[model samples]
Target: MRAGDTAPILAVPLLLLAALPAMGFADWLTLSASGLAMGMLLFLMASGLTLIFGLMDVLNFTHGAFVGFGAFIAASVWARLPGLVAAPGLAANLLALAAAGGAAALVCGGLGLAFERVVIRRVYGAHLRQILITVGAMIVAEQMSVVIWGPDALTLAKPASLASSFIVAGGAVEKFRLVAAALGLAAFAALRLVLARTRIGLVVRAGVEDREMVEALGYRVRRLFVFVFAVGTALAGLGGAMWAVYAGTVTAGLGGELTVLLFTVVVIGGLGSVSGSFLGALLVGLITNYVGFLAPKLALLANVALMAGVLLWRPRGLLPLVRT
Candidate 1:
């Protein structure tokens, strides 16, 4: 669908007229920024899958658990940083937030590596078995997190300093929200640099191309597999941490069945490419954010329709880097 295919284009003029000149521009700009910010977060979460599928050829179903785990950890730490110290303000809160996110990444990464070593290794290249195991793992992880952290939803607050919202065109948005978006974009750029420029990334690319060959050439691909899994888990953790701040809650199972939605992004973006995931996520994010403006009932259609159209046109995905 082009510009003409959308009702938003038609509605924009009328909405502008209704709002007057200055109000319309401000409103549009703020909405667009929010959309972009949301898109960036999607990109962060989807990036993990891109690498996992790209390098390992594994369709992990339990990836979302890492995200939920991260969210829980972040929410708990952010909301309770004062308890950790006599006086917890902006600096302490930031440190706690970082610590929470970092700790979640570590914990998730460790679990990922262990899963890779203990169970995933046996499946090797078995996609079907991997699917079964991953689904089971997801259920177990979700339930275990609930048991450990309980079923209650918890709020994640930004520090009073950071939580403040700045007025943009008469509307206010949280500073933490903007920071989270910027962080996601920065992470993507860093990831691109790592994959394209570093030795670790070169090996990752090589491993993606031919795991057997990479192993046969004496480069322990098993270690690489672990690395990819850990990295994927870490990204999930970061996504969770950011989500906690954005959604203002740390409820269990936040990433529960959403693995399917993430997979949709991965497939539509391309199975094994970072750039593809980033592009797909941004598109999905924008659609999700702006679709409401196009008559609330037809809103969700934006994401679904965009995905369907992409898959229809590119069955292997938009940037099918790998034949899979």
Candidate 2:
């Protein structure tokens, strides 16, 4: 990819940030920003899922559990160490919050790797069996989360300074959500760069296209699979942390239909396609935001309708290319 192509991706959030000041607070800017923010988080989570199932061909039914686990971790940190998160200075607070994110991602990565080795590895290529195993694992993980965190819903706390909401046109946009949106965009850019410019990315791309050949060439395909799995799970974990930070809450809804909608976004974007994921995300983001206002009763229905239209019209997804 050329630098010119990369420049536009880097420019989107900049453009959005610039537009923020011009819009009336009540004007749809807050909803647009929030929708994009949530959409970006979905992009992060779905990127990992698509890569695992689309490329490495691993069925990770427990991916949501990883996100839930990460959210719980961030929630715990904020609940325990409010001082560090609320500390003054952008650099310091960002660093501290990033540390918390790193911890959550790494923990989730370890769990994902272990699960792949002990459980998912056994069912490679067996979609039916993989589904069963993953579903079972999901059950176990859900039960564990509830047991540890209790049945009550827990809300994450933003630093006192960030919890403040600004009036935008008649709407309210939280300061912390703006930060989350910016960070989420950064994560999207970083993931794109990794896939486009790195050697591991090349191997991952190749593995997705032809794992048998990659392994026959004396490459450690299993290790590559494990790496991809870990990365995907970590992204989901990061999304969880970001969500906890943005929404200030954690609940078992992580494994139910809410989780299914996320997966649907992944599918609509096309499995294992990074650029496709972002594009699909923007579409879903816009649809969800606008439909909620026009037909509040069918907000979820709107997203589903959009996905169905894409699937029925293009079964393989809008973008179906595997760069090897």
Candidate 3:
């Protein structure tokens, strides 16, 4: 990695160190673990947006709608499969959860394809049009969800096996958080492998760097863009499913509320950069948690403050893509 590449990475430890002086060791440990888990979840959701922006250069304000819809879909799945989710066996609970996540991904992936074809295609290269149209689409999606789900907040219970906490170094860490962290790591590793080692990954990266060149090389760039959008939406769906369970409730506005945070993460991570998104997420998560604990009144301003600081230091974001 280049010297410039180390800035974002070192930021994580720096934030942690800064927090340590303000809290007790045990409190810090617990909060840090929770922060990391939250960050991982955010990364899972934001990574797709970054990829979509990086490769397709489309500002998909409707992305959060996918998340809100996915949460509802997964909630429905859990409601229908009570026997599986309520089973005492961990395997049964896990299987049921996996099924719900898969269902969300499949449904949202299909929706993303349709969204790209019908809504996004017309607004290509027009940032203002894209923003207005996609925001409108998001509002419509939220209303559609309210119509289908009755505008009531749906509750999602974690599996019995994952509802408790484990003690580590005298600090209590929630099992669900651990699961979330693990899943986030897996997603990151999988994305890295695919983007670094596979042919499709090569084409995607090439398209991101130079779309005209990739098209000139005989690859169908439009089709590839559609697929990337699908994948990005699928990831959003998956993250929404996980988040619904974490928050223990779902509402049509859930995605709308997250939209701000998601954009903050994408910008701080650097537009179109996954690794930057991951690091940016961690920083946001840590800062929020630390601030919430140290000064409850400023908790809400934590992310805004962090974003301002990062932008001041790196205007393009922590890990901006290099364009020739």
Candidate 4:
């Protein structure tokens, strides 16, 4: 989609206004920021899946397991580095968080490589088999996590510096939420720059459109695919670490619970479009937060309703990529 497209962008303001009837300006601001933060975190978790699906046409049900794994890894790291996280200075706290996030990403990226080699390689190009095998893989991964971490939820406290909120005009805006939104924006920008300006990104995009042709051009498409998968998995892991801090707890089933929502964002955004994913995530986040506050009973159904409404309007999603 071109920059001129405004339909998706317009949805944000409309949704914000729709919530005005239920609360005052301060409440609205708080909810809006919260919703945007939630959306960004979702985008982080879902973006990689969208890329993998768009380029490799892989139905990776086990993607959620990576999220859970990343959260647990980061939590373990934090547990071991309590002093750094609870330090008085922001730099120390941030450093601890970065360390945990880096560790999670590295672990998940390596795991993704192994997953592609062992489980995913056998069923390439077969959607049904891909789904089945990946789902099975997810179940196995979840069970293994339980055995390793115990079947209980783990607490993940934000660094002391990030645990507080600041007043933004009269509304309290969380420090971590703002940080998450910034990180999400940074990730989006970096991804776009890589795709638009880098040689590897060019090869990846070309491969997405026509793998055979890219291979015919003498590029190592297979290695590129593996690299893309690893990157995607790492993104998911990083998102999970952020989410763990956001939620204050991490469980083995964290990824499973979010699978439906992640897929909804991906589908609404279009299979492979990063911008679409960001827009869709924002919509879902706003709808969820607003409805949850205004009409708690309908909160759970908000995303489903939003998805149906969007698909009914645009069957291919808001900004579906035109496959070459």
Per-residue lDDT of candidate 3, residues 133-233 (tens digit):
99999999999999999878999878888888888777778988988888888998898889889999888888878888898999998899899999999
TM-score leader: 3
Point out where model 2 deviates above 4 Å: 1-25, 86-96, 165-172
Which parts of model 3 are misplaced by more than 4 Å? 1-3
User: Candidate 2 on 290-323: residue-level lDDT in tens?
Assistant: 6676578998888888789878866766565554
lDDT values for all models? 0.74, 0.75, 0.89, 0.88
Q: TM-score ranking from best to worst?
A: 3, 4, 2, 1
Q: Could you tell me the lDDT of residue 199 within candidate 2? A: 85
C-alpha RMSD of each candidate structure in angstroms: 5.5, 4.3, 1.3, 1.4
Q: Which ten residues in a row have the lowest lDDT in candidate 4?
A: 1-10
Q: Which tens-of-lDDT digit does each residue in 100-161 have in candidate 1?
A: 77877887788778888887788868999999998898889888888988888887655556
Which residue pairs collide in model 4, if any?
none
How big is the positional error of residue 28 in model 3, measured in Å on the Cα after superposition? 1.3
TM-score of each: 0.85, 0.86, 0.97, 0.96
Worst 10 residues of 2 by lDDT: 2-11
Report, for all candidates in order, the number of backbone clashes: 0, 6, 0, 0
- Candidate 4 lDDT, 1-324, residue by residue in tens: 577678877877888887878898888889999999999989988889988988888989888999989899889998999999888788998898898889989999999999999988899899999999989988898999899989999997778898889898788899989988998889988988898899998887787778888999999988888998999999999998888888989998988888888899999998888888999998888888888888999998999999999999889887887786
